[model samples]
Target: MNRPTSLVSALSLALASNAHAATAADAGAGIHELQRVQVTATRSERAIADVPNTVDVIERERMDELLVRDLKDLFRYEPGIAVGSSFGRFGLGDIRVRGLGGNRVRIQTDGIPVSDAFSIGSFSNANRNFVDLDTLKRVEVVRGATSSLYGSDALGGTVSFITKDPADYLQEGKDAYFGFKLGYEGSWDGLFGGATAAFGGERWSGLVAIGHRQGQEIENQGEVGGVGSARTKPNPQDRDGRSVLSKLVFAASESRRFRLTVEGNEDNADTDLLTSQGLQALTGAFNDSVVAEDRQTRARVAFTHEMDAVDAGFADSLDWQVYRQDSETTQYTREIRSGLAPPTLRDMREREFNFDQRMYGVQANFRKGFVTGGVQHELAYGLDLARTETRQKRDGLRTFLVTGVSTPVMLPDVFPVRDFPISETTTAALYVQDEMSFVDGKLRLVPAIRVDHYKLEPDVDNIFAEDNPGVAVSDISETSVSPKLGAVWHFADDWSLFGGYSRGFRSPPYSDVNIGFTNVQFGYTAIANPELEPETSDGLEAGLRFSGDAVYASVSAYYNRYEDFIESMRFIGFNDDGLMVYQSQNIAEAKIHGVELKAGVDLGALSEKWRGWSLRGAAAWSRGEGKGPEEVEVAPDVFEEQIVTRNLDSVDPLTATLGVVYQRDAWGAELAGRFVQRKDRVSDPSYYRQGGYGVLDLYAHWEFAPGARFNVGLFNLADRKYSEAGDVPVVGGASATLDRYTSPGRNLSASLSVNW
Candidate 1:
């Protein structure tokens, strides 16, 4: 592929940076990974080696150097993490931490939680991919339950994105800064560009950043083409997105500051559903086809105040923020179905599905340092208050192509129906933690607790009433308390032992608690579950870490137990109306255990002859199972209850990543490999079983001038064809369809960035 003229011009103009020399020296792959500092673990700055938890921080430099284009690329080398997406319609969907994904993992930008991921039937899906990577300064990921500190939707882990600030670009004497980057990705056939500008005076500073991208469908390794289920190629698609981020800062004094931020982004995609052709056999229609267009938009405004070195009676430092975010997802789908037997091709149906949410929140936290007797203590406390309104609507029309007449009825479904009533959720929480050090600061013990209250109010409207009459929506109020204890001991020089115990919980979601729908033609009905209980988990983890000049390594193990797992839309036998009834229920108890290992060696530190060479690797393995009650029929019309235990299919098999890197004065390169074991353990044996595979990747960066640099990556260097277990859909007996989900083959990605 030829480079665009604009990209060529930008690259030529960017040829002036000597920054790569220092980047290679300061960002050594092995040393940097070992000594990284992060803020997500405890909402305070702490070195990863000192924090009593598993945390991974990806800096902007690393993101650029690796050519990370999406969440899948961001976590490609991280063990036990994966990104799942739709088959052909909605591109990226959600991030899976350990064995849990979707709402189980909490994601936030700055201090605000991201929008939720929701799915209904087969036509609509809304995900939580709202943040643009170009505007981010750093990303922090903490694995394991963090609800004691974060709140709901954190049973598995948490991911926090910190955006860039003016201070990051402006130097001590420089009052203005400007930079831009342009890039291309082959797998997606994408073109992207972004620019950042910052200007400031002694007391005030402002920054603005904008990014845009246009791309075609992501490529895959599938060989077959054409229409219907036999087509293994990706559907034809075109996608584009734009984002803007602006910030203003004011410094009242050296110890006090205020900041205002406004950010917004919009993404759109249109796909021709060749894969959906002839899939309407159940509807007695021949030669069926579908086309879909989707749009996602988010806007947020936030204000924050911070005071440091405030020797007040109540605290030493304080931070607070107030923000509002509005997000929406809209999908429009059109289907053309031919009449049975004669094949008239006259039936046309259109559907517009939407999910919208608005949130307002205030969060405040403070830190105080004090001494009691011989023990020095650092105390942290915070409070969170938020209210959100969520709504969903499904509207459609049916038309006769011959007469060009449209009708509102499309069989079992009517136009403009809500799966669940519009609902508002309000939440309030308070949390506090105290860090105490003993043995002359060699030992640390931290204890924390959080109290949270949540209320759900539903407003049933005419659309809901007309769609599902006689159904009553219920309100809910609930409270939960989560506690945690952690300890870190510096047992010996360059060695530490750390362990922690934490509790996590998630309140029942509005859609599950008050969901109501009926399919008269299919003889089925899904009702609400007003008595649903919250899901909770208790996790315990321990690890031993060694950090030295020549080598760094860590080995950790964890075990978690979960209760009241909600299973949505589960069949509960026939109702009095002789229709199959389904409802959400809390019916399972689960247990998961895992172990992780990470190690790196800096050869230069071992000997002078081995300078500029390093080796790093990480591996993870986990197993999970759930136990639930099942009804068995011993005689006619008589059923008895029995306990059944099944493996959790979501958990990926053992995986590992390894990298070898070498750095020179102005250039560096890394060769990496990712390996996964075969997935054989699953809850359903009929589900497709994927075999093990390994892939190799190469990445390099070079600085040709004082202010310009280029980074390139060759992924899947061997052109191997393999599918991640999480990306494979359940094809059941149809094994041929599995090819459609295979990952892309060899691809090239490169970017050129400049600074002034």
Candidate 2:
């Protein structure tokens, strides 16, 4: 476990992308009919199959049909992506793309970066993938290595979510489109409900969306511990979440338009779980018991304007948008336990952490047609700028037991969460891009360049955080650059080819800059190097697409070389007090590669008399490996030590799906099979290994009643028992780079809806 030429070693162990899932009815016109596909993958509308990249776009109807509760549900259909790979009933996960997850992935909503802009080694700093999936109209996934026009965490590619837009479906002269739904479950005693209402006129429109979800403790299902598998005691936990999305758009003229949108969401929950080394996961249950409480709120306001033929005549339909984003959250931590485990008479401890961030930015674009070589050609250009400010605070009372890992405990009754006041982070970015087409539109090319500048002033958190005492680490400010280039060739109406390459990076995160540790190995003294470099990746992607009136298929391949991958490495250091500390620093590298293929056929032509019956299936498979000598995939920095496995677990492999979508005038139904290839790469204690798995789902909807409709669905129809990964990166500096989190059996849900 002591050698790694790069920051990480990873490949083929089932690497998937951060898939945002939302199901809807067939893209058809009628409630149960197939609708036309109008996607915006290139910042322009077109069919998903027509887009050159290996992209998956899921619509609102499909989203509804799937009854997607959160983003991680992708494992149900989309094979390669597993948000909470090891998500047990709790559903926590690390979004992975290519071979990297957590912060290495980039996410955006309405083209604005929502990831904690705080530098955390060139990826999301939360390391905790944070997008809540409820408020989405559609999710567009750009798979593989990307020199994507976007900069930042996009090194491993990007996932952009488009919130519901009210204009798309509203009738030309209709004033309103309203809908509502409710659902419940038995496992966690869960209940969910939502409502949407929109009103629009000749030149203006508005919409309001509201929703709520609540659930009690989930059944542990014996994955944590077991004899044969029985109901685990209910942990004292409950959760409630809600959101409101509102927007207004104005059509100024035939060639001008403007829009404004505001969104707000909040989640509050109380959780109960046990910590391996003697920490309670929740607060309250008893005087000496621990529990956890979390609360968060996010708000944003955005404005957009579109105008054709600016005064200078240098453009056509100019587009621009400006926005603000703010968020605040707090966590209360503690843990409680019962009979199965021995009590350490642990003293109660309470910890609270708060975070706030503010960001503002704007972008402008132009497109025009020009005469070239006696032929007409198109020209496009765009630019964007943004600035952000972030603030964080930690306040808590933690109890530490000087006793054994088991039984007896409670030496210290209470301690504050952090001995520091607060810290601040700020960032800014700007970029420009352009696209040109030749041969009368048979060939197209795009090139883009972006520059990002970062600065940070991290305030320490330890009571003795500085030279005065036991401080483990701190944050520093640094700047980095990202650039990209790409091209697309339209060889025929039914086929096209594409290639893109770029250099990308995500700044270091809060935990990477602040978390402190003890213990070291001389030259390996891991300390937060405020001077640490940004995690960087150079990536390339190529793909082909074939589509005709009724059939579609796509093949894509990607590769990336990652540097300063920012993983935990041992650092040796001695405080003025002579207490040696081992901290986390930017020191790692990884080579990520993969190939994906997706295809489907329409059975309408062959099924004939069946009228509404058509069948199709899509699949993806990818494999990778760690690069260079010494540089192996290092586990999270939590574990102090671990035995090196025979080899690193590659989460990437073959994944496929088969299903049928039936389209009848009054009813629609679907049946599908989900599969994961048998895991051949094995690592860890003799008892742990991965095997293949398959699950079935059935869904149907009836809309004979005009604005009224109903639907029924069965997930894991056979009640299959299987284990999915909930990859937990250890925190205490243990070399145990990966821990498998498991899942429970299966369940079902149904819903009815009304629209006007």
Candidate 3:
């Protein structure tokens, strides 16, 4: 692909410093600049401009300014990122980056991985959107491959949520402080409130927070069009959620610190399926209902020590952490059928599905800075060990008339029908990275490598094996090595050219390795594949960055090649029971490429009147393709040839965001517009293309008192009826439809926060 001359020229002329590196003067003057430091990029606190990669940070102030309602709102204006939900579902979505989503991207809070990926029949993995926005201090996103640093499941990138600490809320000389926040959303008739308390002594400090939110169903643009048009409205939902966070810090000595943290979150909702309204809706089912409950908890203990006091020649700092995390999701459903002639209760059924996962891990990191032969060098090394266990079960009971009496009976157990066996995975990794600077710090280079070994073991119960006589389940193990290299040339005082090559990989999750299903209604059976190979990718990126006191701009292009891409394949041949077989296999080689551009300016640099004004904008475009086998008929009877198609359904459309802000002493306001191009490149018959659209938003804040503030937001100012480019329809399923899920219409929200 050729580079666009206009884009290249614009980027060259408008470069500035890192997005997180603002000077004290710029801060006091309310001049927005890219001036914050981040640690996720290299596991060390450093200015974003100093790192040779594309990184985005949403600071606490920005979060408050945007009045974000959920995790999706946090990335509404970020380039190369999108959030998507399953068809006909609410409050259930996943984050996608560069066309990859699900388990391919890793999500963590405070450096601890959250939940394991799991999907059962008619139920998908619980979305990771339960974190309280009010408790977050900042969010860091790293684009492109990060497996070299984070190990498996980072084939795309990584997102880390950093929570607020006691120090963040403590006053200069105060021994304790308390804070509270209240918010309301008009779109869903939602109410939210939270309280936090922090205290600090001579040697120890602690912070605790509790938050809760309740809401009715989210409103959307009226009914969808097509066969299932009647199901246009989302299922009726009533949700209640709560979150808790607590942390304790002890300064044992001038050079050492210890911290303990605990966090918990829960979301419960009741949904009315209303299944009788769709084209293939249940004919006789009535009063259908579903209840979903999801919970997550984590506890961690960590220690950090500065080695300078001990005269450790090779080490400047050392850190170690141990943590345990657990998550569970349970869904229950009930339905009544009355299709008989007498209209009597013909059938009553109750079903439940439960999934639980637990993880334990420990990690250690050491950093050393030194000079070798006139060149400055910084070296970092780390080791990680983790173990995960997962279990899933499904059960149902049906009542029918027997000898003129209604009696409830248990359903027969079958392989892949009611339950899945327990599965366990253990992983160990070692990694090292070195940062070197030469030519009086004008040229910098970073080289890193990681080695990982993982084992997957499944303990299938006798019931499943007995039901499916020929099925075989066994243990699988694999090892992978990833390497990365990056460099930056400071060609000018405020300009730099940067590039890097990185490798990433994703091991098969438990669901893919041991998944088995026998769908009698669909006349197909899916069996587990113990020989699945891990997916791997090699990515190359290059870009130029300009960082000036008043202007910041960057443009980067990246290409990624992937191998052993795992995809589900269907075979025509039937098993002994006359059922078609579908299995996941390494079926394709793929490639993805894209371009990202961002620019921000403090207008005050141009005129004194614009001292408190700034403008910011970002745009991204990406495309992907893969070669895989397709069951196409050439002569109306035979099928052959491998075809090329869009590699992943999550490929983002051309998206852009532009905004203007004015901030002064105690008052601030912002206006922003978001746009997405139409997506028609789909080649798969199982998916639908999304149309393009744009929306505008407005926000304002006022600090009425020393420790109090009020904020208001007006979303979808134009009240446009549209769907996100990533909101494609799920084809050929119960929830299948030709219409896309429309976003919420015009909505209003207000919040008040106070501290003392």
lDDT of 3: 0.72
Counted clashes in each candidate structure: 8, 88, 16
User: In model 2, where is the ten-residue run with the lowest total lDDT?
Assistant: 117-126
Kindly indicate the candidate among 2 and 3 with the higher lDDT.
3
Candidate whose lDDT is highest: 1
In terms of TM-score, which candidate is stronger, 1 or 3? 1
Candidate 1 on 508-546: residue-level lDDT in tens? 999888888887788988888878888899999999989
Those runs of model 1 whose alpha carbons end farther than 4 Å from true positions after fitting are 1-23, 26-32, 341-345, 631-641
1-756, model 2: which lDDT tens digit per residue? Answer: 444322232322112121222223432222211122433335555444434455666767666666667765543566556564332223454556655665466677888776452222211122233445657877776664443356556666567778977785488778889888787654556788889898888888888889888987554334333211121333456888888888888888767878898988887767554322232245222332445676767888999898875656577657889999877766656543332223553433444556576778887766666675645545555666666655554444434343423322222212233322244555555555555666766676666666666666666545424322344455566666666677778798778888777777877665556554323322222345565678787878888877665565667787777666555434455656465655545544556566766655555644566555555565666654443224244575533333232333435446777777777667778887777776554333332455567878787778868877776767677776554533432112232222223343466666677778
| Residue 275 C-alpha lDDT in model 3 | 35
Best by TM-score: 1
Residue 627 C-alpha lDDT in model 1: 73
lDDT score of residue 720 within candidate 3: 96
Global lDDT scores for all candidate models: 0.84, 0.57, 0.72
Task: In model 1, state the lDDT of residue 139.
Answer: 86
Model 1 worst lDDT run, 10 consecutive residues: 10-19
Clashing pairs in 1: 16-705, 16-706, 16-707, 17-705, 17-706, 17-707, 17-708, 18-706
Clashes of 1: 8
